[model samples]
Target chain A: MKLVCSKANLLNGVQIVSKAVPSKTTMSILECILVDTTNGEIKLTANDMELGIETTIEGQIVEKGIIALDAKIFLEIVRKLPDSDITIETDASFKTVITCEKAKFTIIGKSGEDFSYLPAVERDDSIVISQFTLKELVRQTIFSISDNDNNKLMTGELFDINGDEFKIVSLDGHRISIRKIQMKNSYAPKKVVVPGKTLNEVSKILPGDADSDVTISFTEKHIVFEFDKTVVVSRLIEGEYFKIDQMLSSDYETKVKVNKKEFLSCIDRATLLVKEGDKKPIIVNITDNGMELKINSALGSMNEEIDIQKQGKDLMIGFNPKFLIDALRVIDDEEVDLYMVNPKAPCFIKNVEESYIYLILPVNFTTVA
Target chain B: MKLVCSKANLLNGVQIVSKAVPSKTTMSILECILVDTTNGEIKLTANDMELGIETTIEGQIVEKGIIALDAKIFLEIVRKLPDSDITIETDASFKTVITCEKAKFTIIGKSGEDFSYLPAVERDDSIVISQFTLKELVRQTIFSISDNDNNKLMTGELFDINGDEFKIVSLDGHRISIRKIQMKNSYAPKKVVVPGKTLNEVSKILPGDADSDVTISFTEKHIVFEFDKTVVVSRLIEGEYFKIDQMLSSDYETKVKVNKKEFLSCIDRATLLVKEGDKKPIIVNITDNGMELKINSALGSMNEEIDIQKQGKDLMIGFNPKFLIDALRVIDDEEVDLYMVNPKAPCFIKNVEESYIYLILPVNFTTVA
Candidate 1:
């Protein structure tokens, strides 16, 4: 295999594909990046069985061939090399030589035939979406997904599509987050549960530009995200997601509109008394004079007051400060409305148009001193 | 105690003094910061027996008293509070209340009598120097100081003051780095060894601007640094330093000058093949054309050619790339001259006026295939 590429172009391609490379693996071939200069394009591919990424970088291919090199070493060499034309050539024995300006490196590579290729899937069931929206959806909800595998269904997010309305829901046992956006066209209803790890990685690599679009195609066991010159494919989680429709409701005994920034800041300050990993609840007492957030822990006691416009009956409840801060941080609106049924029930926060809804179960704090 | 102060000013004082507060200790008072307002100033102090720090914060003292609070909690509370006038008050029971705008915190504090005070040190011996110069000197040579306490003297830098010329030297057996700067006036000769940990902490808090100045005073067992309403006192490491004057030689069998940046880059790229914690040597072969740097390891082999001006007979040598990188990274010169005696001898790098000198020992690599 022979190729001449600029340092900048090659480095970009390597960084994108490296996200799919497993840090530690029993099979040596799984840690290698397949560099193929066949079919008139220079493509780099990395597959870890569960997730695979590939991209074609701009380069002048002198000879059409294939070879697999250690991703870690190749990346470091390319990143530290001077910004000049880099020539990469490999012989039949897999002895590769990389030269750039006055620096040269000679390393051994494995045959590309030993690498595992991404599993093929049909792309007929496709949906087009904006990259900006997809990134926002993933960032705003990925945190609510369970990190452990105790409940396999909760480790992934449910992507529900029905006609022009599309929504993504993620829930741990404690809370559920839903983001809904309008589609450009109506289509048949479809549902798929995507592993949280895949969406997390995809979100990191996706560019936040409104104009660029990504075509997403899903099969029975696989899903693909195509944007720009890169394609990310991952296996879908095989399980039935929870039916959360009954959990999300518009009924409320008390509601209040508070400044988003002020509420987030208040909760953040109240949490200063709560030690990390401790579930000390932040008690919210709403009266005629806005609201007062309080927390008492082993460290100390803190109380923060925030002015808000209250409606309906006044109520006092306790919640995990982290859940409130997480939802409030991603909200761009100046003011947000929160509804509550009672002190023991879950708190609901949503917009008037139903774009996004956050439900957090209140923690019991009756035994506190 | 009762006082009102701006969050910004109080936080700055807390941060500086908190550095001396030990993270973990059996005596809880060592982890607390003493706040004293009795002398018409809001003074904060922290002492860990080995080192002590104190700084006076700007505040309006409404009541004269004293108390000690946990450094970690106080710092966090001040950092997250709103940028408003913060009022801190304590009663006879040591129940401290800190209020800022609409937020308030109630915590327990210890009696000020339990806090350890900084020891009195005679300040008869003093030297004034630019803060910018002191910071730069510490940064350039501190990397060479030994981290382990196996050899007590190697863990500190030798500060030798001879009249108007002052020099500091640090060595870790493998390499010796020396930095010298001229003083404004001549004084009595004095020598001391400051602990690397002290210098490192001092550098972090020192302002890099050229206009500021710092007063340094050394005693038999302790050293003091006073600047900008803050004082840092640390215990000095005792023992005799190594005699390295004989190693700083001017005679050479082969000499060469190369672009500092290009040479550094070449060596950095060559070290990519060396695994972490592995001692791989970069071989240098100098002749008429210039120099060739080569490295062969289990991963790969790399050879780079750099142009230089030769002044003597050809020579070949091998060195640990890290030693070269450390010196080159700190030197702010466009071109550097290297003087070598033989393949097994050390390399000397210095300026015409001997402002700074770096000596790196060559390694034996004749047995490698």
Candidate 2:
């Protein structure tokens, strides 16, 4: 295979797919990236069995062939090459030669026949969404996904679609985050739980511009993401997601509207008193004109009051400061309404439009005086 | 202890001393920072037994008292506090109250008597050097220090002071680096081996202004550095540093002057051909017009020619790319003179005055052809 590509274009293509390259796999072939020019285009692919990424290079194809090279070495060579046209050629013996300017590299390449390619699924049921919306949805709810693999289902986020409205929910037993948005085009209702890792990698590769749209197709065993001349196929987790709606309730005895920035900073400061391995929770006390955030630990105690518009009964509750900070950080609204039923019930941070809702269970504190 | 200090000043002072705080120590008090409001100044000190740092904070001393607080929590609290003035007061029971704006913190403090302080050294044999000069000298030679603790002397750099010239030498068995600078003032001859860790921390806290001076005092077993209202006392490694001067010789068969940037980049690109467990040496071939940098491995081979001013006999030598890059990265000269005796002996990168010298032993490549 022979191809002449711009250094920048080749480097970008390699970087996008290298993220899925298996670093520590029993099969050594998984560590390599396959450069396929069989279809008159140079396509770079990397697969870790569970997730796979394939990106096309914008270059002129001189010959037609296929070869797999070590992803790590290939990336380093392409990145260090001069900012000009790079010529890559592979011989019948699979010896690959890469040249840029006066620099040339001859790296031993593995036979492409041994390389595993991403499974191709029929694009029968697919949804089109703006790249910006998908990126934002992943960033807002992905953090709430449980990192522990004991309960495999919790490690993935639930993507539920109903008519034109799409909702993504993530829960880690301690806290839950839900983000709902309206799609421009309506489609069949579908629900799928996607591994958090796959979403994170997709978010990184997506373009920053909002004009571009990404096509997401769902199959029985896999989900395919196509955008920006790249296709990503990730294996879906086989399990039923939790019924997040049943876990969320609107009943509350106290409701407070507080500035998001002020509330976030107050809880952040209170968290300083608690050290790692310590489950010290910050207590929030709602009064007539303001709310106070407090954290008491063996090392220290901190309290900060933020002014807010309060309604309903005065309440006191304790929660993990990190849970609140995580939810508050993703809420783009200036003011967030916090609803609390009692000290034992969960506290909810939601907006009036019900587009985004965050529920954090309060910690049972014995020393709340 | 009672003091009202600006949040920025308190944070800066705490950060400087916190570096000396022992993170994992048998003595719990070593992890705490002492806040002493005595001698009409609020002084913060942290000691890890082997190394200690003390800095006076800019604040108003309301009452003369002393207490030790957890360094990690104190720094976090001060950093998150309002940018206004922060008032910290300790009660008789050692319950410290820190207040800034509407935020308040009550942390448990230990008695200051249990905290170990930096040894007070007499200003007997001390030399005053510009902070910039000292910082530059450490930056130029510290990378050559051995990270291994097997040979403790190699983990420290030798500071030799003679007449008005101060020379620093560091060697890690494989390579040796020497930096010498003429001091503005003459002092008694002294030689001390300062631990690389201490120099790194001192470099971080030095003021950026070149006019500021740092007073370095040498004792029988310790080295004290005083600068910018902070004093760092570190126990010197007790051993004789390697005789690096004898290891370096002016005798050579070939001398080449090459552009430092070009040589460094060529070697860096060649390193891409090598893997972790492989020690592929980059061979430098000197000729009448230029120098050719080449690296051959089982995976591939790369050769790049860089134009240089050559003299003497044509030669070829192999050396580790990392060692050459390390020395070239720190040198201030645009064009560096490389002197080599043969393919087996060490290659010396030095100048005419010998102000800076880096000697790297050649790696014997069996596959050299």
Candidate with maximal TM-score: 1
- For model 1, what share of native contacts is present? 0.86
Model 1 misplaced stretches (Cα beyond 4 Å): A367-369, B367-369
How much is the lDDT of residue A275 in candidate 1? 83
TM-score of the second chain of model 2 compared to its true counterpart: 0.96
Predictions: Cα RMSD each: 1.4, 2.4
Which pairs of residues clash in candidate 2, taking residues 3 or more apart in a chain or in different chains?
A: none
Worst 10 residues of 2 chain A by lDDT: A360-369
Chain B structural similarity (TM-score) per candidate: 0.97, 0.96
Give residue A230's error in model 2 in angstroms: 1.0
Score residue B347 of candidate 1 by CA lDDT: 95
Give DockQ per model, in order.
0.79, 0.63
Worst 10 residues of 2 chain B by lDDT: B360-369
lDDT of 2 by residue, A1-369 (tens): 899999999999999999899779999899999999999988999999999999998999999899999998899999998799999999999888898877878889999999998887888899989999999999999989999999998999898988998999999998999999999999899999899999999999998468999999999989999998999999999988998778889898999999998888888888877878899988888999589888888777888889999999998888888888999999999999999999988889998888999999999876656
